[model samples]
Target: MPKHISLISLLVVCSLWNMPQAVHAQALIPHTLQLDAENLERQGLQLAQEAAQLGQFQQFDLALPRARLASQLAPNNDRVWFLLGGLHLQAQDVDAAMAALEKANSLNPENPDIFFALGSANFQQQKYQAAADHYKQGLKLKPDYREGLFDLGNAYYMLGRLPEAIAQYNKSFSQDQKFWPAINNIGLIKYEQGDIESAMKQWRTSVEIDKQAAEPLLALAVAMYNQGDRQQALSMGEAAIRIDQRYANLDFLKENLWGERLLSDTKIFLELPRIQAALQQSDN
Candidate 1:
């Protein structure tokens, strides 16, 4: 795995740096009982930094022990609890993540980031309402949080609240126009609502924004095949898979929120000799 340097580590380092000289000495040395507490806090921050570095590379197994130790060493430190929460969340230990994050939130409820991480954990657990609620709270704290908006949109989408989902996606786009996931998700809603033309337009615009993005390209190619343009569809489909081989599977397509109509159409398209040959050729 690639070595990682996480923002959590930087933030911890900065926090330590910002301390006064006297406290810094106390944090480093074990001269007295009071100083020992400071020393433990400093050690916790170090352990938290190590956990974050490992977590960044998806080594949650290795990261979790360090995060736990950090939290134990500095029970009052919100950042230490937050790191534990993040590690648990990454490892899909939703219950543990929520517990740690709840502690972090109690320590610093004003931090919108804790709510966002809670929302993400809820989302992964398929608790859409909880996710939406957490996202709403986080967004209220920081209205321009683009990822929070997008995630709220996803929660709405999962709840079958299409219009609300689109509204959230549009809000995200307003904040950062180049956010391709919002554009792509809007296409998903449009396609599901039987607006193929609008969906195509969105997908095309999405592809224009990021040529190597496989999501919209696959959607466009499937739409093209459904519209009876074999050669163009085959070429586009080939290009889509070339950009990301994961797009070649039905499960992956469904995960992208391709509606049943499009899924059925794509299944038919993929069975064509031309599409198979072209996709096979591209793999080589």
Candidate 2:
């Protein structure tokens, strides 16, 4: 799972909300009590930083507990809540992720990243409409956010709004031509609409942009095999599987939003003796 949310700076900035009311009046309160509060907040920030480092290494199991504790100690800090939400999302706990993300949004409603994270959580839960809505809200704040546009495209695709999906994908690609996933997904939509030639073109462009992208490469291979280009299809299929063997599985393809037509063709392609040999070779 991709870590959708990022840890913000740990250097605590004093904001008007948390600033002491009166410098003179603060002398009336015990110095030790203020020091303890400061110490606890500092410790919470340190723990949050540790959790973020673990998350970067994809150690979600270790990260989640620390993030949870950090959120408890730094209850007023939106960044702590955001990190907690991201860890839960990586762990596939959609409900927990949503709850933490909503809390983060409440604390800092102006932060577009929090809304984008909420969109991702909604996406995981299959609430495509809500996901799209959240993505739109985020985009309004930061119009050129590449990932947010791609995610909105996915949400639109899931909702059967192909044109809108393509528009969002194009927007994302415009932001960065090297972003192959958006192009790959556009190929998916084209293939589903029976535009094999256009789909192949998009997939080819994706492969040209990022040769390591197995999804578009496998889709192209499957299409080539269906069109009677056996030799090239087998070679391309082998190369794609070498990059990522998971693409050989139809279930994995489905998870990536491969349409029924493409999946049917890929199923047949996967059963070919040469492809089967490739899969076995890859396992070793």
TM-score per candidate, chains pooled: 0.83, 0.89
In model 2, the runs with Cα more than 4 Å from the true position are 1-30
lDDT of 1 by residue, 13-42 (tens): 675688655465455433444565677789
- Which candidate leads the pack in lDDT? 2
Which candidate has the highest TM-score of all?
2
**How does model 2 fare in lDDT?**
0.90
What is the model-wide C-alpha lDDT for candidate 1? Answer: 0.85
Candidate 1 local Cα displacement, residue 94, angstroms: 1.9
- After TM-score superposition, what is the CA distance of residue 282 in candidate 2 from its true location, in Å? 0.8
For model 2, what is the error of residue 226's alpha carbon versus the real structure, in angstroms, after optimal superposition? 0.9
Cα shift from native, residue 14, model 2 (Å):
33
Clashes counted in candidate 1 amount to 0
Q: Write the per-residue lDDT of candidate 2 for residues 98-154, one digit (tens) a residue.
A: 999999999999999999999999999999999999999999999999999999999
Error of 1 at 216 (Å): 0.6
The lDDT of each candidate is: 0.85, 0.90
